[model samples]
Target: MSTAIRPHLSKIVLAPMEGVIDAAMRARLTKLGGYSRCVTEFIRVSDVLLPKRVFMRLCPELAEGGLTASGVPVYVQLLGSNPEALAINAQRAAALGARGVDLNFGCPAKTVNKSMGGSVLLQEPDRVAAIVAGVRDAMPADIPLTVKIRIGYHDDQLLEQIVAGIWSAGASELAIHARTKFDGYKPPAYWATVQDVVHDRARQLYINGEIWTVADSYKAIQQSGCEHLMLGRGALAAPDLANRIANDAVDQPPMAWELLVGEIEEQFLQHDCNSPRHIGNRTKQWLAYLKRHYPEALQLFARLRTLRDVQSIASQFTAHRQQDLSI
Candidate 1:
């Protein structure tokens, strides 16, 4: 691996969550300042080549200079079954100025798995190898290529095959989500399985799944014997998560309503997010977690959830946020 890729092996990376980790969320989390890199939500691939507009939509940060406002590089992830389609899309994203390209094989969403995407691909290591090879061949060498996969589909029956195929296909880094497709989002992420893989494979390893606190992160880091972590839900639950792990507490401020409001406003203004309904949907989803830290925000979230118009929702959101701050 080139020097460009080695540093990534030692740093914490934010997992690419489909709907949850939008540019706004990335911007907010990156501001907390611990992630070495962030992967944008997966770009679903089709048989036909994706238009530039589609790539832009999946990863708006590409046009915003390939990094979130916090100056963190965002790798664009691609999900698909066809090698050609995935490769073409991956290359297109790299050409359009993404920092890197990551393949998603850990998504457990039925909608994705039913289509022979995500963790389902773990059952077909040969196919995974072919797809990875295609994209690696097409993408720039200095631009890192990583793959995220689970331990197995429903079992570890083909775990070795999957890991070998990923390496043969030229995946410079591998992130193991530590559970089967059947496991869903439940507990016991099987960090031992990922630890086993790291012991065997020469590729870099990132442990993911159910790391919701600093204690959990430390345990994962020690258990997996892999320094790198990819936080999915944990970072969402606590915005300062990455900062805590990195031991950089200078900006480790609490998740106040003001910070949340500023992030929402920045996302709305930059994305030209006009639909109050759509904006509320994203804000409300985040509010569910933000509420945990700042319980007072829940009233505003509940009020905003009922309103259909964006204007009313925004007004209510603002009022509630202001009230929370005042209190």
Candidate 2:
């Protein structure tokens, strides 16, 4: 690993969440503070080298030195079972200016698993090793190569084998989501299981999943005994989460609904695509995540859910802001 890549291993990172945490969302979150890096939503590479446009479409930061406007590095994540194709795409992304590459073996989505991608690879440790070795060999030696996986597929039986495979295969870092495929997203993340596996081989292991607040962050660090963390839904639920974690604060001041609306509008405007419905839907998707942190977000989402016009939603934000200021 290059000297540049090693420093990032210790920093807090944002997880690559499909259909969420796009370039705009990354820009929004990183600007709020305290994320050392963010991973782009996984680009599915099954066969053939994906076009440059596909990478840029998923991660516009690729065109901007692979860093958000806030200067946080954004690594491109790839999900697939084909070793050669994944290597081809990883090289392509690096050539196109990706700061790093993350292989996804942890996503438990049914469609992804059924397609022989994501956590499904956990059942075949040799396949996982092959994929990691292929990508690591294909990319420049200086660019960091990382693997993300769940504890296991059906249970924790394969946890140690999987980590051993990743480490032996030349991956510079490993991130484990503290649950098996059977565990899904519900039930608290089993941090103790992650701790048990990482305890023996501590080389750059990052714990991810269910780290929702500053307290959760502390508990995860204490229990998992891993200092590095990757935030997913929790970061989406509260954009300032990484900032709070970095500052070691019990709580950051709540963002006003009006300010949150402004951030959403900014994301909408940053999306240069021609689909207004797409923009509206992305806004609503983010608002849905925010509902977990802000009750006002629920009311806002309810008011905006039926609207297909992005302009109409923007107008609603204006009205809502006015109402909020008056109060």
Candidate 3:
């Protein structure tokens, strides 16, 4: 199979972050302009074949030809330990309109790892290979099959072997988070280590981790020698990080906190959720990350954290907008 890393393909991608970069966030971020593609949060696959509703719930972009409103493609990601089950779900995702399928072998959450899923598979390179091969075979050739993995579970000792197995299994692209499962979300992404293993592979290797700004993105590119970078928390913290990185700009010019809050409001209103509590929690979750970049966001989160009613949150956002206008 041909590699997905084409010579012309050098762009930033949104990382598949569970509970964060849902369909609403993807549409909002892509609309801001920068991300080349976005991956949905990992759809957990267990024993049975997941239904279309599950995929739809996770990635509503599937209903619109798998592209965000701004035209960025969204890939559906799956996480599980069973090879056949993963493949069956991958096939169903494709049939239901997933433009691409990404296999997740890099989630390091204790709960996920304990369940014999996520980065725990990194300890078993053979199982990773089999899972990737199964998914690759199950999906249509037109839809790209990608894999996301950490360097290793406990260490980078088997990094090379893991990469080799993933490529041999016919993954079109590979994203290395540049941290061991044990490393968690610490500083120092170990970008330099990936250089020794990449060594002229045809597959596209994306470097992800600890990139919080455009400067960090440049440093990651310099250290990893990879032009393609994936943004996770960094994008969440600074919503315009991808735009700045794509434009080769320094960083987003300071904007009013109310504008950012309004964007969040827009996203929340657009989302098709049955409960206002879900929207309220989602808004608070976004504000928690935004606090990293905007002090006002911290204040906003503090005010809204205890509120379960979406209308109350929206009222606060309205007041903030009015306050900004008054100023």
Candidate 4:
């Protein structure tokens, strides 16, 4: 082992990817082991307080005490610019059994930005602080309130100010996506920039973006100098990445592609059969990510890319699984 010092990495959070990583995916990924927590897709809160049904629908884990079947905490994520509205809905989530609430200030989608909901908020550090402070105060102190943000809006000019404001506003944890909104999921996350500004040892920090393998995680930790990480698309690309990183098995082999495809198929069949038009879209999205790691995933994606029906996709999965069994 190298003698250079490395982060202790006490937590690994499953990043909330909108239209992906829903309740079923959370359950499946957390079940495979080594995740400390999961976050729901951001529930868009506007001027009104959303109903209980909305909360329950986005985060079914609220019905299960804010935990997946595997017992990992699923923090309810809320996105909006209205501090009052955000606070009210956040408290509602807590009252509905959410153990933690995450405020999303990092989404870069044009629709979200135009609505003044996501990274657009980063342009105004005080507004971000107000939203975080308002939500934090409304919720029980015992319930953790976390904030997620990109490094900045168009540049890192306000990075220090933003980080300071969120912490000063009482956010218990801050997860930085490491890229400015202008960068938009591109390469060069500037992981080391986090170490340059955020120096508070009292609060936890999770570094995200461009981490798709064990080697990537290692470099992210060393460069960011942060102890915790948030896995986004990387988690889907390699479903066992959490376990691999947790165990420090840098060279550990990925889960067999056959077994992974089978698990994906089972989840799709169990939780995704209801919506006819959207039957195989989510599975295909996941396969796109998985293809980055497993050649079989690419081949499978090619096979199912043109198919949209549940029956057809399900049949392909059956053949895929039977072939694995025969092997």
Q: TM-score winner among the candidates? A: 4
Give lDDT for model 3.
0.83
Query: Considering lDDT, which of the candidate structures 1 and 3 is the better prediction for this target?
Result: 3
Q: How many backbone clashes are present in model 1?
A: 1
lDDT: which candidate is best? 4
TM-score of 2: 0.92
lDDT of each: 0.79, 0.84, 0.83, 0.88
Instruction: Give the per-residue lDDT digits (tens) of candidate 4, residues 247-322.
Output: 8767777898867877888887988788977878888889988888888877677778898888888888766656
TM-score of each: 0.87, 0.92, 0.91, 0.95
What is the C-alpha lDDT profile of model 2 across 1-327, one tens digit per residue?
A: 211111222368999988877888888899999898899899998899999999999999987899999999999999999999999999999999999999999889889888899999999998999999999999999999988999999999988888888988999888889999999998699988887777555648788989888777777777787768889999988888888778766555556666776787777656623584365788788888889888877877877888876667777776666664453
lDDT of 3 by residue, 31-76 (tens): 8778988999999999899888999999999889999999999999
Stretches of candidate 1 exceeding 4 Å from the true structure: 1-10, 200-203, 248-273, 276-279, 317-325
Off by over 4 Å in 4: 1-6, 321-326
- Give the C-alpha lDDT of model 2: 0.84
Error of 4 at 126 (Å): 0.9
| Predicted structure 4: lDDT | 0.88
